[model samples]
Target: MGREFIEIFEEWAKDYDESVAGQDPQYAAVFANYEGILNEVTARSTGTVLEFGVGTGNLSEKLLQAGLDVIGIEPSQAMLDIAKEKHPELTVLEGDFLTYPVSDTPVNTIVSTYAFHHLTDDEKAIAVKQFKEILKENGKIVFGDTMFASEIEKQAMIDSAKEKGFSALAEDLQREYYPIIDTLEDIFTTNGFDIEFKQMNHFVWIITAIKNKE
Candidate 1:
């Protein structure tokens, strides 16, 4: 279901950095938001960090600077290759976050930025369970992406997009291509994880969930 996104991103890899300018008037604001995400992730845990959808090493590069060994799991080889080329020491496996192989070393933290919407809501549930299996007791999982606080809120965003003629995007949002923050919290909290989230803007959110085994 997500392969089409992979193809689009693969072709966009080369110009990805510049492409943001066309879509966003305040392009620098977007990168700044990601930097905020990096700060939050770094402050949350200083253990082994695994980043899913580590596209072009944008977020992973900062993780490395924060002195964490990062294993980046990316679905697009084109994006993977770019991320790898920049951080040769980084271990990047060509894989999807929902089904990436467990890390050989027990991980203490996991982070993903602007990703996860590729998975359906049901798929996200499976992914979080998989995250629990790979993380050590009390390990932290923090991710920043397009997450909504409620179904009504998500629908509102979709409706706004549709009004602007972003029909495909609206359909994607309506269909399970995006995550509802409430649904995600229920999945993790019921399974023994502590959850916290901050909405950065109307369309983006930063969620931090730590495994509470203690």
Candidate 2:
């Protein structure tokens, strides 16, 4: 589970909006075109959506505005608190990608943004497997997060971050478990999904995976 990063998120809850707004110069490139990325994810989602890592309800707000039924799950209580305060009408529960309550309604789409990197590759595989089980026939998963084309590309980005003197950004890259596109494709295909990826920015990619009917 990604609960191990709850404390970090709790601390980040206050300045997260600023960071995503490109106010933090060090991370501006990382969050480039944040609004467009959120809108792209919202555009791909449909029906009842189970959104993991609904940090501060930014994407959730978009889903609601689109008139889709949204169920948000977050691990950090502090983050969840702010999200609830921002959108009182949204139902956000305290949970991570791998540990969340079973939804009462059939899930039509699963979504997340900039948060899935919290899970390691193995954990991501498990989460995808779980998604397959819970999703309705032909359901989908749309996630926008930091991912790389290959391991070499991932290390190159980290090295570049350090060279640019972005210590925090470099450390964040070294710390998190950002997956490679190939690994994600393998995971989704092995679990019966047709997956596609679209680069949203320098760091983020919008991954849309739809379950294949059995």
Candidate topping TM-score: 2
- Cα RMSD of all models vs. native, in order, equals 2.8, 0.9
In model 2, where do residues sit more than 4 Å from their true spots? none
Q: For candidate 2, write residues 104-202 as lDDT tens digits.
A: 567999999988889898999999999999899999999999999999999999999899999999998999899999999999999999999999899
Worst 10 residues of 2 by lDDT: 97-106
Q: Model 1 segments beyond 4 Å from truth?
A: 1-4, 19-32, 165-176
TM-scores, each model vs. reference: 0.86, 0.98
Per-candidate Cα lDDT values, in order, are: 0.76, 0.92
Which ten-residue region of model 1 has the weakest summed lDDT? 21-30
Residue clash pairs of candidate 1: none
lDDT tens per residue, model 1, 1-214: 2555887668868976664444534333334455566677667766888889888887787888878878888889899899989989898987787667664688999888777777776777788888888889889888887777777887887777777777655765765477777788898887679999887656777888888884
